[model samples]
Target chain A: MSLESVVAQSHVIVCCGSGGVGKTTTAAVIALHAALQGRKTVVVTIDPARRLADALGLDGLTNEPAQIPGLPEGSGEMWAMMLDTKATFDGLVRRYAADSNQTEQILENSFYRNISTSLSGTQEYMASEKLYELAIESDYDLVVVDTPPTRNALDFLEAPRRLAKFLDHRIYKVLMLPTRGIVKAVNVAAQTLLRSISKVVGTEVIADAIAFFGAFEGMEQGFKERAAEVDSLLSQPDTAFILIASPHADTMAEAQFFAARLRELKITVRALIINRMQPSFGDNHSPEDLAERYAGTPLGEQYQCLAEAQHLARGEQKHLLGLAQELAPAPVVQVPVQAFEVSNMATLQMLGQAMFDTDVTSEP
Target chain B: MDPKQFLTTSGVIIVAGKGGVGKTAVSAALAMASSSVGLRTLIVEVEGKSGLASLFNSAQFSYSEIQLVEPSLGVGEVRARTVLPEDALLDYLKDHGLKRISGRLVSTGALDVVATAVPGISDILVLGKIKQLERSREFDLIIVDAPAAGHAITFLRSASGLEDAVKVGPINSQAKDVLALLNDPTRCRVLLVTSPEETPVNELIETAYSLEDEVGVSLGPVVVNGVLPELPGLQANPLEAAAQAGVELQPSEAQNLADAALFRLQRTALQRAQLDRMAQELPLPQLLLPYVFTSELGPDGLAQLSNGLLAKIRDLPDPSRS
Candidate 1:
């Protein structure tokens, strides 16, 4: 159940977890490992924090994948990129629009500008689309995706569908139909309601919405088809999900929920990564025995603290063991908390080694 | 201004930080501290994560305010509630007599489009609801456990964004009101929480700057949570101390002790460096909450954190008196 095996078997690997769980780092290291093992890999991350670039020893990353600079020459290649949601949306508009004029109209529309860039789920949707595009069209042997830090991990899976549904709804088309003809066709009550809404939300917002929808009129089919492709790409057997979490109760609960939800979506979760676990000092001596053994020594209190640390580590292990039981049959890997921050290649390499050093099926 | 005075005077306090940094716990502790000082405190959470309920050991919290801690000599009076954006939208629709269509819109996913398609509209609604509650004066203090850092900035800027988007309307007027409240330093305070780590600390600094520059909201105090306590005299070496004490230790026991002390010392050093960097960069009042050893942050754990926070607040100079 090594990460290497998972990488070898799956063409697409999606790393998902709540925030601050080192998900980006995990994804990067996995990609790095895969690339070093002679599989051309690209890690696409959505973290605006730019930790991926830092991890990959790059000054910065854009929407396009840039080759990582520092790795010793290996058989396979490694490239990393950050998802620019706004740029990706703009690109999609250009790709789907009938002509440059239509693309310009859609891009300039105020509603489209707001929703495409700053909307909550737009980034998730675009990330999925980008991942699907890379998986299907790009030349990489493996594609690793670091998902958005949404409260519910399932939002990543639902975002594209939500966008497609919004686009395919009848209201957009009805609102955007030629003004006079639509008014004549609709009932008086509905027209009056529309007038009131325009007045309430401002005519400018309504006009912007109408123009955006009108410009997007012919592009709905393309968007829907792409959404379906991304959906299938995620659910297909070639894709695998890796759920990352820390040993904290709240995070573990989230991981468990995400695993169950992914299962419900019919996506296979190949592995669970428990990051930043406190290393156990072994069960040879209890804190009480240590305290008794070091009585009247200056190191007594220090020994007591050590015992407490051991106890905490054991407690964390017990909690993780419980989680393992809950996620039975899904292999679990544990990464111990490093003394130093992971800002350099050495630390990342060390982390990768430590991460896979254990047998994934064994109790951590 | 002093942290204590800021807490005493501000009618609304918003706690924000990155995820897993104990923002909810800090918010709950702040609520407890405020209530203990005789303020009729109301803590609100918008994520609908039930973090507050679990922390308070309550069954559940709905959209309505419920009494979490009744007025007592020691604990004082505190109430908790949750505000979901969807429910807020429904309430807004109900106020406008469009309640009948609200359910259909939500069911068909049209409501989500309208809420999200308009920049800052959803956040404006959430803040608008909080503003209404503040205006009602039902509580002496209101604490909102806002979303994580990146989105929290968006939440705080909703007022300004709305004002910029809508020129003349009820929404515009309401946004103006919220903006006034937020811009008024005396009425609102923003507290940033972070665990003593590199990533969270970096995020705290960035978010603090954004809160000031983008949202025009001045930060009150930075709360650094889950800080590990440093063991005395173990900074240099623990093995030397054991050897100096003439204690014969087994190889495994010695190895364990060294490993434990090494982790503690290393973590303490890291925390100190990050805290120092934060102080140097941010130049704001900061408070540190010790790491609670408990596996679960239940009521007792929260109480311990509350006491630590209250002590820190009390230590601050009272600007009003001066």
Candidate 2:
């Protein structure tokens, strides 16, 4: 498939792999290629390496969409944002709330803000909702996302369902412990637990939780509905997931495991980009020939280093082939190891070239 | 360095310290040495830095157990990869080549990425992988180039996060197995690496207490990198002379001599003060690495570091013996 073909067809490109495998860089390159092809693209990176800025030659960026410079002004625009987990969570709460008053109450309530933003996996839910909004709005022709490195990276893909389940659950209403009159003997289990917690902690923290739940009482379904909408948008044909990995066994295993999970989940596995790949000079020199030629040679030391490097490269290539065999056998691109580290856009463009500039169909 | 002493009951050795304190370099050196001695070793990190890769001169590495070097050594760099529920099912099927007949099952929600993108998710997976590596016994040593001080506790504490999320199931069972390995003192140890700077020193001390209090991981040795050695036999005399000469010295040859002496005095004083502070704060034994100013810490440099620091560590009697 040509770069244009993938860009034109794939709607959602999800980059995943082991950390330090250049997932963020790969995402930026694909997005940039899409934009250059006259498709509006937005790249959202969850990588803290902040290499996305380097890929775009941007010094820094905020959570909001910032237009990348140096691309032709009118042809296509590439907008990038580093995912700010907390701010995104806050934004989601505000955006999905029924009205300004409810939004204000949720925002002002410490318990709501803490559980919504600081609680583990909250950011993942927000990121899911945010992407769903962008995908549905059709503001960009394509959206490229960089996922957090976690075993849950696969589970993260299931976040909308989990969030929706929690939103739809009756636990919050039960936790509210609505005060009943003296005539009716209501279930005081929640009230007793709240008082017990206060006694143990010497504070009325449970009161804060109750207040937060009260504000969120009526609008929980709104959140659940958005979660449902997102759940549907993710599996659409327009969406494609790119599995990024390095030429390491552990990374390949992760890619394979992720690919397997994707198969199980039914996400479109579009293509695999093996980042920071080592180049194989090929097996033109047999081991016996290499040994005999270097036996009495004056360049023995240099030969040894070259032979060792060649050996390492071959090992990496073997591992990459194994991953390909394990996956869907789509277009596999290998980005050769650069002499210099990727710290700026020039290098990233070279990386993009390594990824997108290849003869598209040559499977690794 | 004595490999025997190093591998005594091989478990997990997490190297943590302030950012840029040579923790990565030290972890790589230790892992390399461990592997050289016929021990299966794995090094892990959260940030996708190929700090260890550059040392080994390898370009591609992974998050699962892939050997970057020959024989017994491996490295896993855990970067998050999202598989939407539907897509995950499809990926599973496609690996089985099920995409040919049934491809409609893929879930397209962005929720997977959104939910897993939380701050501690990376930390949780990172530590979980490290814990997994530690348990395999495929490697005698599991060296973790842990995140900087601020997040080290959370990285280790991610076990709790996973446990909370998975109340019951195979994932919960896996979490239990990993947590068992983590809590075993013989199976794991946390090594704090620090420089002789104020911020890193304070952070190291704070991290030590937090990890102990929050995660219950015992703090190991504090490896102080880039430590300046004292000028032998050139101590109080020069400093006293400088202090006595309150009258500013003129720009002369003697002034340069006095200035060099004063520089040595100041550095020695600073080094002593740093060691003293660490002594008061941390109960663990401290290891010191001499300053090497060059930017690159390649293979040869790493070997040299392993030899030098391990030699110093060997020379010191174990506090247990004392």
Candidate 3:
């Protein structure tokens, strides 16, 4: 019902939207608001844009929590970190391995490193794992996450299950099966095929892969089960998924898709923050008059340009208003796009206030 | 254009970088440039952002490409990935007579199960479509206003990966065609757009190396947009520093002092330092664009940016000419 209410109950707050729509800023603002309300908060961002650090006034931050400066200096603190997907994956393997030797074997494997860094769903898995770790650590009352601009935005939703399945698949079990003795014709045939493949590829990468999988024999089910639990934690109602989008048709469409997906996954989308929205002045004569006056001059041409922007702003506002009307169950907050970028904390706070206006959704 | 010089078999020019770094803007510009040279070009935007629509001042551009600059350039917004997902590809396939039977195949845990079981199934479909567009003989170049850096790298790499995973059928052959286009340096050029920011710079460098190593596609160059102009008279020297200290600055000299102070020399210096770091870290030559303080980038403004780009292009030997 209220921003505070959601903050108090929600363990995981996932930010979803198209790129350049200020989803990261919304996540940071929500995290800041929670911390300000006497709840320990950590905003974890996977956006490659690095906007959270800028919004929080940090030069840069690593994967671990870095305490932010000048946050009113109180009992409830705010910390931020950028998710380094590769590092997190490496850390997980290192932690879960049977021994240091096993860990080294996996790390040195080409397949593992490639899958950890460049794979599509890997970041989403890492993000979920990171959130699960944060939830387990209980250092913070809430963890706000900014997801990467994915194709379906479902990867964030599907990540835990996907990883769990990948770890627990029959292929995984087959790969991990120890080859203590190989008297069978099938083993000999496979070995010959592997040798031919190695010669063609100019590397023994397959052998390296098999060795890495061998080290994970006893640890497979543990990782899979952990992934399943993490997935449950994410889909629970306590983990609020906040959908952020602009007022543009494209952004609104994205919001719709995300909303439907969230509904399917049974994740409660408690609120929607429409960022960079154009505020409606209600019967403003400035745009028309200005456009007419500057009709001939370059400044007039400039006004012509501003006219579309003004119109789009008005349209977006109307669209958001329509969305709020359509999705009446969920509270939608509209933060008008400023003339300049929302780069500073002062501006972010202002936006937070605009977005969480008490008048919009009265607290229960 | 010399075919021998063309590094790529298909000219699939993908414009990608960090959001707000003007990837769409550069994509439109590159499309216009290619089309103006009499090469038929189609610029496809998957997210339906319609940044290209706004640039072209069109009311609406749909899945059906609308001609922007008659006989040459065109732009269109396909179904945004979020809305359709695999359905977008399904629609494309259905239009090509692949049919609902195929959809049923994908859903029944038979075709779908097999596809899903394959390591890079989605990559095959998503990239197979884009690669098909690239290979279309109707256009000389297909400019894709791709997703931002994180996803774009994965999208580009999908071609070769699918080729390896689907090593035997028509899909594998299609993957080979796409891979040939992508791996050929001349036919396909990957342009990265950035605004002289640290994160974008670092990401761009990371993307360049990743593409080079993983996919064998050389990153063209870094297009540094929104660079500040050097105002000679307003330059901060020892004289200006002394003036700021209140000794050299008088009422008569106040204009220059205020001017120097207000122009954000410190921020500009820091931005330049970041740019310098980019030049050092990235092997690709950088194209620096002058910053426009104006609210909107209209046609004239875009033309100015394009002119600056053209001059930069002239300095480098045209691969086609070479």
Could you give candidate 1's per-residue lDDT for residues A142-236 as a string of tens digits?
99999998888888999998888776765565554556465646444344444555655667776676567778888989999999889888887
lDDT tens digits by residue: candidate 2, B129-178? 56655556656677777765555676678666667754664335545766
lDDT per residue for candidate 3 within B1-322, as digits (tens), equals 2221221334676778877666767776665555545566677775544466766766555555566766623422221112122544455445444453454435422222222333344455555666666656666677778777776777778777767754565556667876777777767778889877655677788888888888887577678886765433334442444434344434433443333233334446767887888888877778777654333455765667766665566566565555
Model with the higher DockQ, candidate 1 or 2: 1
Residue A215 of model 3: what lDDT?
A: 62
What does candidate 2's lDDT look like per residue over A1-364, in tens digits?
Answer: 5444666797877777755466777788888878877888998887434444665767777787788888865558888888777787677777777899988997887566556544546667777766776677758888988876554467567776676665443434544435433422343543443344333222333455556667876666777787777777777877777788776655676677778887887775778777655444434444334334534332222223334345556766777776777664467777664544455666666766777766365565
Candidate no. 2 TM-score: 0.60
Q: Evaluate model 1: give its TM-score.
A: 0.94
- What is candidate 3's lDDT per residue for A87-188, written digit by digit as tens? 998888877788998888778876666567545577888888888888776667899888876656778868766665554444333333336453455444
Model 1: CA > 4 A from native: A176-192, A288-297, A359-364, B1-6, B108-110, B236-247, B320-322
TM-score per prediction, in order, is 0.94, 0.60, 0.65
Candidate 1, number of clashes: 0
DockQ of 3: 0.08
Cα lDDT tens digits, model 1, B6-38, are 566778999999988899899999988887777
Assess each prediction's global lDDT (C-alpha) against the native: 0.80, 0.61, 0.63
Q: Looking at model 3 chain B, which ten-residue stretch has the lowest summed lDDT? A: B75-84
The window of 10 residues in a row where model 1 chain B has the poorest summed lDDT is B1-10
Instruction: Give the best candidate by TM-score.
Output: 1
Candidate 2 displacement at residue A343 in angstroms: 2.9
Off by over 4 Å in 2: A2-4, A48-51, A72-75, A167-169, A177-203, A287-298, A359-361, B1-13, B16-322
